[model samples]
Target chain A: MLYLQVLINGILLGGLYSCIAVGFSLVWGVLNIINIMHGSLIILGAYAAYFAFTLLGINPFVFVPIAGVALFVLGYALQAGVINRVMGAPVLITLTLTFGLNLILENAMIFAFKADYRKVIIDPPLGLIEIGSAFVPRDRLYAMLLALLLVGGLYAVLRTTRIGRAIVAVRMDREAAALMGVNVPRIYAITFGLGALMAGSAGSLMSVIFPISPLTSVAFLGKAFVICVLGGLGSIPGVMVGGIALGVLESFGSLWLGPDYSTTIAFVLLLALLMFRPTGIMGKRGFE
Target chain B: MTGGRLLMAVAAAAMVGALPFMADNYILRIATSMLMYATLAMSWNFIGGFAGYPSFATAAFFGLGAYAGAVLQTKGVPMIAAWIVAGMIVTVFAAAVGRAILHLRGHYFAIASLVIADVLREVINGMTNLTGGGMGLNLPVLKIDVTTQAQFFYCAMLAVALLALATSVILDRSRVGFGLRCIEQNEDAALRLGIHTSRYKTIAFSLSSVYPALAGAVYASWVSYIDPAEAFDVLFSIKPIIMALLGGAGTIVGPVVGAFIFQVMEELVWRNFLNVHLGLLGLIVVLLILFLPKGLLGIGLLSPRGRPLTAKAP
Candidate 1:
């Protein structure tokens, strides 16, 4: 029964993990650049949700799309105006640029919203649903469901839509896509927007379940990097698999090794995986 | 070398060397920390700037050195011996790990290094008997107070920084430096031209780790306390990279210049700006990234366009 509970918890946690990973992975897939400030951006989304709840009195669920859309536009402009200029520069330049952006965003958030932690007062119905011999909280179950839906929706959009094809095309061959008359820059911007939007949605969901703070992004950034590496940079479905594996590992690792090691496990796993298997699960080999 | 330039450098070093004697305790303290940071940044440039492999595990190596020193102190070793042993240990670990993980490229190597840092910290935390778990460890003073210790650490750090600069300048003109540049530009071509890319990178990686380890040892000794968080702080990893980038990576003076400028800026912000300092720092990085991707000393300022700047001392 304990094992069952662990599995269910892991699966649920994995859903949220997938949400975080997919956003980061999408950005990596499309732009060939690691968005170092991604975690900070997610925290920004969480803060947005907090404001929506406290000031505007809107439901946290209702604020998801609103925050997502706003972040999308912001990400679009960032890529279009700034990142595009140094698209093909050395990787060090990209690293320095994004790293600087991360510092700026993190510090900006800290200044704008003080270091105090905030959480949305959901006041949810504290009911538990019995599944076989295990019980699950309604809140967690809802969060898990929403995360799954978002991942599925994102996967579908990428797999089935015309814009999605363009994105995949660009990722595969930027020059070829441009030669094929695709507006590569526009597609790149949209992909970045979508990636940031997914992160915003993850943030909104996370605010309801976890305490929100500007610093929370730093922790999640570490987690997201682990997941993206595990799942492979461009492989969307691999994120789901990676997330589930990490969530389970973390849950069990925390149970056995204490919570102190729980957070670091993901990073350790990430390094091990990267050293051994940079391609990640079900992903194309090399550079991604 | 021209006597004028040599004299100028010596004078500058002497002025900085005399700072602890002349300045207030606070200035001395911050200067000590700045030198530590400068050492770290310069060390990191050995790999990230020169060899083109940005290892985010720099904090891990630093933390390892700190812990090694701290652990040796518990075994009743003197601080200086502890620091030397710590540096050796970190050097070996970096060399071994670099040999294995340095095979990866770009972001792959980056994420791997980050993982190493996190993992090392966790592993250290798990050894509760040794590391004191999350509570951290405090060292018993054999015979030292905070101020004098800070002075000692400052001088040690300054010495290490000087060594790093010397090494960088040496490598800047050596055959290995040429090979590294070739590899950075085109690994395939470099390999085709008979460059031992892996060996060169490994040397750079081990060399890069030496100063951080030394700095970490001094920092732990001066503070007389160490913790997993303080030791493995990712912020340390990021700061050096930022400093290297800000001043210009691959240049001998870049990390030093970057560290000095950024540290002073950081001190000023922390002192006067209050809560908005983080925002300001972020803005600075973003602006730098957008405007000066080649770093503080770009082609336009330092050298003619499309010309390789590769001359050593006359």
Candidate 2:
């Protein structure tokens, strides 16, 4: 029964983890920039949702799209205005640039928010549902469902939409995509924007479950890095698999080794995966 | 080296050496920090600048050195011997770890190196009996007066910085240095030319690890306290890279020059805008990368023909 409960909790947490990594994976896949600012961007979305819930009397779930759209604009402007200028530089340059951006965003949040951890309390807190003697919290279930739905929406958009095809085209081959009349830089901006949107939406969902603070960005960023590598870089479905795997592993790991060692275990797993299978479980050769 | 430049270098060194006599405690402290960062920046240059490996393992080596030194000190080992022993331990550890991870290119290598510090911090935290875990560890305090102690650490850091500088000068002209440069330019071509790319890289990685380890040991002793969090702070890894980039990576004087200027700027910014100093630092980094990717040294003063040292083939 305990094992069953842990499994359910892992699955629920895994869904949100997938949502967190999708944007980061998309940007890394398409832009080839690690987007170190990603975790902070997610935090920004959480703050947005928190403020909306408190000030506007809106549920965080209802404010997800609003947060996403806001972050999408910010991400688009940043990539187009700042990051695109160094599009041709070495990988280290871009990585450092994003790191700088992350510092700015995170510090700005710290300055503004005073580094306090805040959470959105859904009024009349939703109770848990019992399934075969295992309890599933209603809020976590809702967050998981919403997160999966967003990921599914993203998949559908990528499969069917014109802009999504342009993003895919750009990812496959930038010069060729440009030759085929695609606005390559614009596509890159859109991809970054989409990534931020996903981060923001995930932030909105996460705000209810986890305490929101600027400091948590590092942990979130670390998880995203591990998940993206685990699922294989740039693969959407791979992120889902990787997220669930990590979620389950961490669940079992915390149970066995105590919660503090969970991060250490995840990092050890990352190092092992990086060493033994650089291509990751679901990643193809070229992507690695 | 040209006689004129050599004389100028000696003059600069003498002036820095005389700083303890002329400056107050605050200035002496800052100078010591500058030397410490200069050492870090130079150490980073071995692999990051010359070999083109973006390693973020500086904090890992540093924290390990601090712990090793702190632990040894607690065991009643003499301080200088502990520092040297810590350096050896980190050098061996880096060589082994470098061999394992050096094959990864670009982002993969960067991420792998970045995670090492985090892992080390966790491990150190878990070992409560030896490390003191989160509660922290204390080294035996020296019985000297405050001023003498300050002068001692400053001079010690200065000596280490000079040692690192001398090594950089030698490495910049050696055959292994040439091999590292070639590897940086094109690893595949360098390998095809019969160069031992992996060995050179591992050598560079090990070289980069040792000085920072020694500095970490010296720092642990100086502060008289050490902790997993303080020793393994990621900023220790990042700030040196920024300083290296700011000065001009891959050049003998670049990291030193960068460290000096960055330290001054940091002092100024930290004084004026304590609240937003980090954000301002980030803004500076963004502007620096966007406008001056080659750093201050890349502005055509150091190189012949007025070409930036890092300029790629057109």
Candidate 3:
């Protein structure tokens, strides 16, 4: 029963984890740059929802697309204006640029939000869902469902949309994509925008569940990095599988090793996986 | 070395040496931090600037040294002996870690290093009795007058900074620097040429560990307190990288100049805008990384284009 409960909880947590990982993985795989600002962007999305909810009285979940669109514009502008210039530089250079951007974004958020931990309480909590052998919170169940919807929607768009075809083509071969009349830079910008859209929506979902501060991005960024690596950099479905595995593993790790070791468990797993299997679950080898 | 440049070096050293005697405690304290930062930036240049490896392990080594010094001091060991032991321990540890992670390239190597810092901090935190966990540990304060105490640390750190500069200069002029440059340009070609790339990198890595470890030990002793957060702060890992980049990564004098300039800039921003100084710092790093990748020395120098100003220091 304990194992069963753990499995259920892990699966639930994994859903949200997949949401965080997929956007980061998409940006990394397509842009071929590690987006260190991913966590900050996620936080940006959360703050957007906070403002909309508090000031405009919009429902947090209803603010999802609004936040996503806002961040998409921001991400698109950043890539077009700055990251595009460093496209040909080494991976380290782009990564550091993103880190610089992260510092900027984080400090801005701290200035506006004042480093206080806040949560969007839906004003009287939602009831829990009782399964055959375990209980799950309503907010988490909603988060899981929304996560799947976004991931599935993203997968479908990439498979069917024309712009998505360009993104895929550019990801596979930038030079080839350019030679074939695809505007590689535009595609790159759009991909980053799409990534931010996903991250922002994920942030909205998270704000409803977790008490968030600007500082939480560091912790979340670490988690997202681990999950993205575990799932594979380019493979979209890899995130779901990787997220579930990490969630379950972390759950069990917490159960046995105490809570203090849970964070270490994620990083240890990341290192071990990077060393032994650089190609995660369904990922192509060598940072693909 | 050219006679003119040699005289300038002597003059600069004399000025720095005389600072503690003439300057007030505030000046001495700030200068001490400047020297410490300069040493750190120079050390980072060993692996980051020369080898072209993006290592984020600075905080890991520093935290290890700080804790090592603190623990040793608690056991009644002499401060200088503990600092030396800390450096030695850190050197061995860095070599082992470099051997393990140097094979991974790009983000793979970077993320691996990032994880190592976190792991080291956690390991230290878990050993509550040794590290005192979140509560932190205090060192034995030097039994001297406050001004003398400030001067003591000032001189000690200045020595480390000078040593780091000498090492950087020596490496820049030596075949080891050429080998590292070759590795940076093309690792595979360097390997094929029998340059023993890994050994050079590990040696550089270990050598780089010494200054940060020593600085961490001195910082712990001078401040009379040690904690995981302060010791293993991730900002420490990147600040030196920024400083080195701001000056000139591979140049002997770049990081020192970068450190001094960045320290002054940071002090100004921090004093005026306490709430958003970090944002300002971030803006500077971004601007520098984007606009001045070659650092202050990299722009068209009087000597020539593509040559850092310090190229003809001798």
Candidate 4:
């Protein structure tokens, strides 16, 4: 029963992580920027939700779309205005630029939020569902179901929608996509915006269960990178696969080793994956 | 390269050399901190700037050096001996890891190096017996008076920075330096041309670690205390990269110039704003990346006769 509960928890956590990582993977795949500022966007979304709920007395979950829309604008403008100029520079330049942006976002959060740990208080914070001998938290189940829905919905749109096809085409080859009548710069902006939207919503979902502060960004950033590498960098389905793998590994890692050592598990997993199979579990070659 | 310019540079060096005799203790201490960062930037430039590998393993080697020095000094080892031993240990470790990580290019290499730093921090934190389990270790305080102690460390850090500068200058003019540049331009092409790219990279990586290790050791002694958090500071790892990029990555004078500018600005920001300094620095770095990708030295306004540092062409 204990083992089963842990597995269920891992799966639920994995679902949330996949949603958190999808935006980052999307940005890295298309724009080829690591988007080190990603965690900040998520934190910003969480705070946005916090304020919306606290001030207007709405459910935190209800305000996710608004946060997502706000992040879309921020990410789009940032990509079009700043990141576009250095698209052709060395890879490190773009990475370092994102790092700088992260510093700004994180410190700005610190200045505004005062580093106090904050979490959203849903109307029913903890409701449990018992299945045989294992107990499932209702909130975590919602987070998992919402994660799958958003991720699955995004997957379906990419397969069916015109803009989604254009994003795919751009990801494969930017110049060729432009030659094929796609507005390459606009596509890049939309891709970044969409990624930010996913990150923002995921942030809202995470805030229901976890406390968030400015300092939490680093841990999130590391996990996003680990998942990106694990699930395979440009693959949509890879996000879910990588996220579950990390969640399970961390689950068992904390059970066997101490919980404090759980953070290093991702680094170890990341290093091992890069050394052995850089393409990742579901990642295709050339794209990675 | 002009004799007149060289003479002026020598005169400036002599002035800095003579500062401890005239300047107060506070000035000397701040100058030492600047020189310490200058050393870090210089060392980072060898691999990150010249070799074109964006590495974040600076804190790993730095923390190792600090720990090595702290342990040895506490065990009755002389300060100079402890510093030398720390440098040697870090060199070996850098050489080993560089071999594995140098194969991964672009962001793979960068991310892997970051993991190395984080992993080292965790390992150090976990070893409760040896590392004091985050409670931190304190070195035996030196017997000298405060003023004399300040001058001693100031001279020590200046010496290390000078040594790093000399190494950078020498490497800049050497065959290995040219090979590093070639590798940076395109590693495969450099290998095809028989430049021994991997060997060159490993050597550069080891060389870069040596100075930071020495600086870390001296820093441990100067502060008279060490901990995983303080010794392996992530900001310590980042500031060097920013300073190197700010000044000019591959040039000898660039890192020193960048470090001085950054240290002074940091002191001002830390004093006045206190809370938002990192945000301000981050904004400047973003602006610098957007507008001045080549950095201060690369733009060459300070270059003798207004010449660009070198042809940017690979």
Question: What fraction of the reference interface contacts is present in each model, in order?
Answer: 0.73, 0.62, 0.55, 0.65
TM-score of 3: 0.96
The numbered model that scores best in TM-score is 2
Give TM-score values for chain A, per-prediction: 0.95, 0.98, 0.96, 0.97
Which residue pairs show collisions in model 3? none
Q: Least lDDT summed over 10 consecutive residues: which range in candidate 2 chain B?
A: B305-314
Clashing pairs in 4: none
lDDT of 2 by residue, B96-205 (tens): 99998999998899999999999999999989999999999999999999999999999888888988998998998899999998988889999999999999999999
Interface RMSD of each: 6.4, 2.3, 6.4, 2.8
What tens digits encode model 2's per-residue C-alpha lDDT throughout A143-209? 9999999988888888789998888888888889899999988988998999999999999999999
Best by DockQ: 2
- DockQ for every model comes to 0.53, 0.62, 0.50, 0.60
Error of 3 at B53 (Å): 0.5
The estimated TM-scores of all candidates read: 0.93, 0.97, 0.96, 0.96
Misplaced by over 4 Å in model 4 are: A285-288, B304-314
lDDT (tens digit, per residue) of candidate 4 on A1-288: 888888888898999899889899888888777899889898888888888878887676777788889999999998899887777667768888998988888998999888999988787566999998998999889988888788887788677899999988888887788899999889888988988898888888888889989889888889999999999988878988999888888888888897898898889889989888887999973222
Ranking by lDDT: 2, 4, 3, 1
Candidate with better DockQ, 3 vs 4: 4
DockQ category of candidate 4: medium
